[model samples]
Target: MSISPSLDTDDLDAREVTDGRYTRVQIGAERAVKVRAAYTTRFVATEFTKRPEDFHMLAGSEVHPEAGDVVIARVTELGKHTRLESPTSRRQLLFVGQEIMVAYGNRYAPDQFLAHVPDSLEPCHLVAGGGLAGYVIETHASIGAATAIEPIGLLATREGVVNLRDFSPLQVGSPSLAAVAALGSRRPPVIAVLGTSMNSGKSTTLACLVNGLSNAGLTVAAGKATGTGAGNDPNLFIDAGAFPVCDFTDFGYPTTFKLAYEEVRNLLAAMIDEQAAFGADVVVIEIADGLYQGETSRLLRDPLFATYVDTVVFAAQDALGARAGLDLLHDAAVPVAAVSGLLTASPLAAAEASAWIDVPVIVTYDLCRPEVAAALIPVRAALL
Candidate 1:
């Protein structure tokens, strides 16, 4: 797909333009692009092939772009903020009339916008803060509109397109499943934080739990096993005192949407094993989106995933969601450790959720309490 570069002559910045194979521009605050930790890595010195198809397109493609997949994009439009949020959660500004290299992928958030591969590379919108450029198919009214961007092309080398997947530190075979299983008693207990939907307070709750466990003097390794790429949640876990934090991006997936069940399971297992290898006493993991989301539902149903989870903490927006989510978990035969989420904000809502579900209703604030978090740990004997 080709799009005419949108230039506002009056809005031009006084920066010198360099002529080269790849023009250097500031990376956007996009999670998918964060795989390489671009805020720091910025750009890798690599060669590119001019063939567009050889490079991946952000929208309307079956190819699942990895977080660090480098693509050259033109700054078609500037937004109110010139800065981009880095994988480490740092924001940096961008100057118009610059050619920036970024990752290509889609983002699906019920509270934000739903974007996918654009029908063509013709200019699309930056649908996410984490530099996810795609065709915005739908958006929540609250977010208004997406940031506009024009695709220049994917970064390629003489060998082929330099996909972030090729550079991923987390490989499928590196953390062998058999090796993890060999740990046996050394594996830490895993507490999975799942939600009814995005913005349901899963990350907040996970951070609280991480904080509580850390305060209890337990070494905690935290990770987001699934979700669209972003640094926010994993960073929160780190700020909350998780010794080491990771997410699906580490495994080279830009977004977890539409991934096969086995692939999702393997990614979660690999991450869990890595945390366990870190000698953490406990691992706090958050699955992105809701239990009903495509990948999430499949993962929840997979017995392999259940093997690693010691307890399940369900987060929801309201009593209705809590009830429905609880029912789904029960039907799947997955253990339900507690009910929490946005509903915790209101005592009435929390109480209402408690009435509908038999599990304890722990608000985010209380979850930070050491004793409260300790009490939520499922019996080790039961897990056995």
Candidate 2:
């Protein structure tokens, strides 16, 4: 087998090719080891559409692993996450000794665990249901400890450690600020959904708006700009009639937490370009977490972000959060067309928010309506 260019060839002499399906590599000159995994591996969400046959070897020599490196691990204990989300979106129950394939990534969900890739392959936590493996530093008091797992080794092929980046279906070569700026009226109007925090109904708002736009005879493309990797939101967008749906994960990132600002900006640009290539009339993107979150705040404040977003739909759980969130957006000069989310579920709370903010407060039902959804589009894009 030809060695992949991306593979680390430093230890080239240590590994020798065999005629069988598995290759034999000498860990040291004195010892020749044929490492074989006897366990049936259950793949996770981040390994989307990959099969066991895709990888031929496992290497545990590396102590420090980077985010997006695929690893094979055995469940040591089941805690908050008793089940893992499969690549097919099925919730597979977890067992104490089950071996699973997952990707390493940092998690920044305040409602859950804040985790980072471990320096060593020591026991770590499954931080997100999306198959992120990291060492938990902090977790919400309301939730139980994260699920524990022991790393067997990183999944590898002739190319070396299999990274999701190597398998991305997207052809988004490079981010071009000039290209995005030049689109002007030719590109579709983009609406961004931002929330007070995780689970503040941002996904629902985006999905509903997409549904309304699709119902209004417009092709809608949707994506989540930043967040931990997960299928729930993307699936929701698909069910709501969004074609060419995307998220940070689709670009090979298991999560957007801790990523550089330029990387995140380029990711947003790529997502829009991917959807626009499909001839979408409007694009909707969701930014994970509240305005105060580091990555979210940076994206909101960046001038490049303004070039991609036409307006924003703010999601909040209460009147005070709605008011505060709107104020923050206003301060950042982000154009917010409406207020919706958990706050809109209750008439009293929505009324209170409406009284405090000048923007219209809308509910899911209203957002699904063609006329109401069309109104949310900025006049420039709408006219186009």
Candidate 3:
């Protein structure tokens, strides 16, 4: 790391080309930060809103990384993830020596990798395609090593290190989740989509429901209550006719794996409120991973889960998973409205699941029907 000659800080408006690379701006006479081929990703899109001149300084020394703390890093090695997901959902390719901007966050994916934020700005892995930088603690055997990146420094301003939460619209002066849920004296029904495990088809089921509800002449809003930060699910919901779709990331969370139960509830509540405020007739939320996962298990057992969610659509990968999943939800006192997932793709498996549990087993096409979709929502009048 080379420290160029300190430039005048008094001329805040003055722009100078430094090192023929990124513009080097002087926060003060002591600190000199340079911005080079930095590619900002989707993780920091909410708070990385500063213009080129808006005090985009970098602090290299005494770097302490925390979840949602935006940092610049140089791509050192390309492995499993060769491209990053941009704020606009574009996949930007990575190359050695190229700089990129991402956030520090923990990840929990049984089918992929489990990673945590590193204590120092040392070499770390690109644990997620959403631009999450962390050191992977564990990974599935099927996947290769994570992409590697060397930390350049933390993104900073005059106040301090720039955190995603600092500029989050949902967290800054926002009402409490309870208060938000109580507005208008009438809360819309929330259909929570849960699954047996990762890649169990939870996202597809949610999207199908969104499409079905829209065809039934009801305004639907969708949200992802927990998961590693990414744009794929939200984009799918939008294509399915959901309006004002939200996820934990919107609340400045890169991932909700280790979040407290209250935090997860608030994430769900805030998203539901945002959709309702936008005049949605109903709201649907998806809980990442399976019933046994940490956050998901705790949330289901807690009473708060029932307050905001009216029904649960259990998604399973097999007939046994569907049966076992329904049993788990039942044991947790959760109401199961329907069962759908990979098992539904097989008529034999679907029939087996239906025979095993009294709940109706449905496929994607079933959810697409206007009448079937409209019926999934428990009579709203009964709740009020």
Candidate 4:
């Protein structure tokens, strides 16, 4: 394995090795530990670790590892020396000779690895660009084999072993009751973006909405309430003119998969409250995966979620998906304000969907218009 010439090999002392004499050093804040970026949203300081046994390889990678969850891994082989997409979306190279810190997480995307938590503390694959160290139970045939990594041990300190959950700002069954009440009391008009499936133009729709709303001079805040740890979606929201954009990772969750209903509810409440506190005229939240996906479906059914969100913008891949998605939302009593997504890319498909659904059918181009956004804002009387 080759080391990057820019990095000083000597900086990593002999004691830092797996032999474990314990070297205390700070993990830099400038470069996010990709898998753990979400944790950094709340805790943005350097953390100290000393021992490998302090870390544990969690089973069942249903949820991607949250930012700040520490893992010990060894480089088993070298790849093409590509730069890793950090939690902050910055790119940096990983050297084969280096012992590194990573987080266990799962990702659900059609274009990427469909990974899971390894059942054992053994060699696994780097299944995600965000350094999701896991076992590649499945893969999109378009992409080749996953990057292999060996689990050395758990990250630890003199105090004890460190897990991302330990540093979470929110706790299970112990959400801030005041914040939840406040969220319901002073909630801003929320436009939630849901899709037929991943890559169904959810992020694109979000960006268009943010951009259009910003262009209309409305103060907007955007958030991705779920999905794996990655900088791309959040970055898009930021670039699209949203201030203080965030995602599930910001709440110290690597991914929202399989999380309890109350916990997920609290996180959403917290996120909405934080953005609403920013005094934005509107808050645009994107729910990951399709409407039928586990977390998304659960949230759609949660009464708390319905109270928080005023309107829904369903995105679909085609006319059929739009019809099905609209039907599902209708059955759940989730109001659909508009229909948009990849289907809008084709006028024929959009027209086909428009024939079936009563709401406005918006294309990517139309979604970028301020008038389209202005039309979707819920009437003040309706909130009452």
Candidate with top TM-score is 3
- Angstrom error of the Cα, residue 27, model 2: value is 16
User: lDDT of all predictions, in order shown?
Assistant: 0.68, 0.77, 0.77, 0.68
* TM-score: model 3 vs. ground truth: 0.87
Q: Per-residue lDDT tens digits of candidate 2, residues 279-352?
A: 78898999999899998898888998898899999999999999999999999999999999998999999999
Q: Write the per-residue lDDT of candidate 1 for residues 44-121, one digit (tens) a residue.
A: 322122222222322222223343455556666775225556645677566565555556666678887777765444
Kindly list the per-residue Cα lDDT of model 4 for residues 1-384, writing each as its tens digit. 111112122344333322133233333322224223222222322343223222222222221233334565666765422445654567656666455556666566666666676654568776655555667777777766776777655444434345555655544444445445555456679989999998899999989988988888788999988877678889999999999787776666666665666777777877877777667889999998998778788888889888889889988999999999999999889988898889999999999999988888998768778887777888872322
On a 0 to 100 scale, what is the lDDT of residue 61 in model 3?
38
Candidate 1: give its CA RMSD in angstroms: 8.1
Ranking by TM-score: 3, 2, 1, 4
Off by over 4 Å in 4: 1-45, 48-68, 77-82, 165-185, 381-384
Whose TM-score is higher: candidate 1's or candidate 2's?
2
The positional error of residue 240 in candidate 3, measured at the CA in angstroms, is 0.4
Q: Show where candidate 1 strays beyond 4 Å.
A: 1-68, 78-83, 176-185, 381-384
Better of 3 and 4 by TM-score: 3
- On TM-score, the stronger of 2 and 4 is 2
lDDT of 4 at 202: 94
- 1 versus 4: better TM-score goes to: 1
Worst 10 residues of 1 by lDDT: 40-49
In candidate 3, stretches whose alpha carbon ends up further than 4 angstroms from where it belongs are: 1-50, 57-61, 176-184, 380-384
Residue 384 of model 3 has an lDDT of 18
